[model samples]
Target chain A: LAKTTQPISMDSYEGQEVNITCSHNNIATNDYITWYQQFPSQGPRFIIQGYKTKVTNEVASLFIPADRKSSTLSLPRVSLSDTAVYYCLVAVNAGGTSYGKLTFGQGTILTVHP
Target chain B: DVKVTQSSRYLVKRTGEKVFLECVQDMDHENMFWYRQDPGLGLRLIYFSYDVKMKEKGDIPEGYSVSREKKERFSLILESASTNQTSMYLCASSSSGTSVRNEQFFGPGTRLTVL
Candidate 1:
């Protein structure tokens, strides 16, 4: 499993775009970058995922450079409801001894201010 | 839509008592997992089941045991509940595929407090 590092917290205003970057220096070639949003007292929800380049969805966009050492999650037109903890995970295929486990780090808390 | 329902949203149990936490998924996913989240520890996997009657221990499985009698249901058992076990328990399920992009769907979690 590749360990990930992200900002502890970030503050953004409503109507502004927010980007949270996660660094996985030892990311494997087969690993994929995934982002999840978690609200207080609730479970984490899937946001977006990407392998390389840029993948855009209705909710967010993921940018992965050629190095694959890091990835960024971009949320367009943020609102107060978007204030939540965002987790960046490096997904890997399970093998004989390793089961598919989504290891969550100390996620970045994004506070959207109105 | 995929739904993962937990038996309880909040549970209060006494020390030395046996407790059960039930999780059921409607998606019929082959993999089900139980994780406990704390303040600084993030989410720690307790146990995971790949198929019916097959289970494996995760990072923290000392005080927790899991049972998977059917494909849709997975239960976590606490033999003797302790105060240190008070935390938010989360259940998640995902499909078994060859891709590296298996996204897990999580339940609303159960907050357990052992006194």
Candidate 2:
């Protein structure tokens, strides 16, 4: 499993765009980058996922450089409701030796202030 | 919308008691998983079932067991509840497909406190 490192917490104002970067220097060739957003007392929700380059969706965008060593999650027009803990994960399969284990880190806590 | 529902939002139990956490998904996904989340530690998988009557132990599965009698439901069982088992339990479901594109849908969660 690839260990990911990200900021413990961040602060952003409403209407601003927030980008949270995750470093996974040991990312494998088959590993896919995924981002999940978790609100207080609620389960985490899938935001976006990408293998390489940039993938944009209605909710957020995922940017993965060529090296695949790092990736960024971009949230547009943040609001107070967007304040949550964002988790960056390297998705792996449950088959084979690794199985389907999603190892989560402390995650980046984004505080959106109005 | 994919919806996963847990039987309880909060539960209180005593030590040395048996406990059961139920999870149901409307999507009829083939795979179901149980995980526990704690502050700073993040989410840890306890058990996962790929099909009915088939299960695999995840990273942390010592004190937990699971059951998958039907395709839409998965249950997590604690043989003897302990205070250390207190945490937010999460149930997730996903369909087996291409590894790169599959995403797991999570339930609201069940906060369990063993006193």
Candidate 3:
């Protein structure tokens, strides 16, 4: 299991691009970087994921360096609704037969102000 | 989209009582998980099941147990409810294939209060 470290909290204004970075020095070779957004009183929702380099989707973009020791989640055009706790996870599965037990750290709370 | 449903949105239980929390997924996923979320602790895994009649303890499994009698249903049980056991219980399911990206789909969550 890899341990991810991220900022405790961050604040951004509307229409701004927010980038949250996570450090996982001990990430395993089979680990994949994943990000999740959790609003108040709700379960965490998958935002984006990446194995290496960069992966972008309609929701957000994931940037993983060649070393794979760190990753960043970029949100384009933030809004008040984007205010939530963002979690960075290094997912490692033993095999297809088992559940990929995700170890979640204290996530970064993003507050988007208008 | 995968849908994971929990039995209750909110629940209240007394100390020394036996409590059961149920979870069901419509996606016929092979893996089901039980997690408890706290303020600073984030989400801690309580138990998980890979297949029917199979279970495994998670990071914080001291006072919690789980059951998976059927493929789509997984249950978490608290033998003796305590105040510390009161928290947000979440159920998640994920397919066995990496084709779905191996991401866990979580339920809305159950807020349990022990008196």
Please report, as a residue range, the 10-residue window in candidate 2 chain A with the lowest summed lDDT.
Answer: A92-101
Using DockQ as the measure, what is the rank order of every candidate, best first? Answer: 2, 1, 3
Better of 1 and 3 by lDDT: 1
Q: List the DockQ of the predictions in order.
A: 0.53, 0.54, 0.46
Question: TM-score for every candidate vs. truth?
Answer: 0.90, 0.91, 0.91
TM-score, chain B, model 3, is: 0.94
Interface RMSD of each: 2.8, 2.6, 3.4
Report clashes for each candidate as comma-separated counts. 0, 3, 0
Candidate 3 chain A lowest-lDDT run of ten: A92-101
What's the lDDT of the predicted structure labeled candidate 3? 0.85
Please provide, for model 3 over A17-111, each residue's C-alpha lDDT reduced to its tens digit, 9 standing for 90 to 100: 99999887766566577888998877888889888999999999999999888899999999999999998877444455343436666689999
Chain A TM-score of each candidate structure, as shown? 0.87, 0.87, 0.87
Q: Give residue A44's error in model 2 in angstroms.
A: 1.6
Candidate 2 C-alpha error for residue A106, in Å: 2.9
lDDT per residue, candidate 2, B14-91, as tens digits? 998999999999998998889898877777889988899999888899888999999999999999999999999999
- The DockQ of predicted model 3 stands at 0.46
